[model samples]
Target: MYGLMSILVHSIMYTKFITPLGIDASLNRFFEARAIDHVQVLAHEIDGRQERRQGLKEAAEYIKAQLERLKERAGSNFRIEIEENAVGGSFNMMFLGHGISFGYRNHTNILVRIVNSYF
Candidate 1:
């Protein structure tokens, strides 16, 4: 009775102080219009003394909170989720997939991956 759609969001943090921010809502809109049903977030890295910057735990929590906020804002407009199980102090990523079968489902599939260093 429905179709299948997929959206992939890949994020890589190669240095210290990598900021893991949520994807923009406008980007979600684009994906929703395409009837995407799955979102894959690839967050790589954790507590590692790669650089003399903020604590790894602190940064991890910050990233988690940011993602939670996005889910709350999305409400029913989109079905977003985060995958936090990375290895080593390397990559950080986030992905959001939306499904809009009744409304717009013929637009572009947007993949918004926001990354920041020394934040």
Candidate 2:
């Protein structure tokens, strides 16, 4: 039984885990639906027991660095937010427009998270 969840950063919107499938169509949809130009998976948790978990701090730092990279790429005029959804096992990267454009229409965002389980 594999569970997966989704998150939207600034608004803190989380989606229910669409379970029982190893193939995540939503993730594919998410990547394809947007003009993601640049995306880098910073933090990743391997499929293992919590007690055996390692690299958590490294993963976190990598994610933070990636967010900063994205911010730089988007320029100083763009506002970015990274929200971790540990409960949902996901993370949301949001971009708020501060110059040249405004609101949802102009700003772009991405949600990155993990899916893991064993039955």
Predicted structure with the largest lDDT when compared to the true one: 1
* Structural similarity to truth (TM-score) of each candidate: 0.30, 0.27
- CA displacement after TM-score superposition, residue 1 of candidate 2 (Å): 36
lDDT of 1 by residue, 1-119 (tens): 12222222122233356344335446434444222322211123334423443445445555576567666666453566566653333333444654333322222222334433323
Candidate 2, residue 116: lDDT: 29
lDDT of 2 by residue, 1-119 (tens): 12232324523555565444333344323343222322223322322223224444345555566656665555344455665443222334545743342222211223543222221
Question: In model 1, where do residues sit more than 4 Å from their true spots?
Answer: 1-54, 89-119
On TM-score, the candidate that comes out on top is 1
What's the lDDT of the predicted structure labeled candidate 2? 0.41
Model 2 is weakest, by summed lDDT over 10 consecutive residues, at 101-110
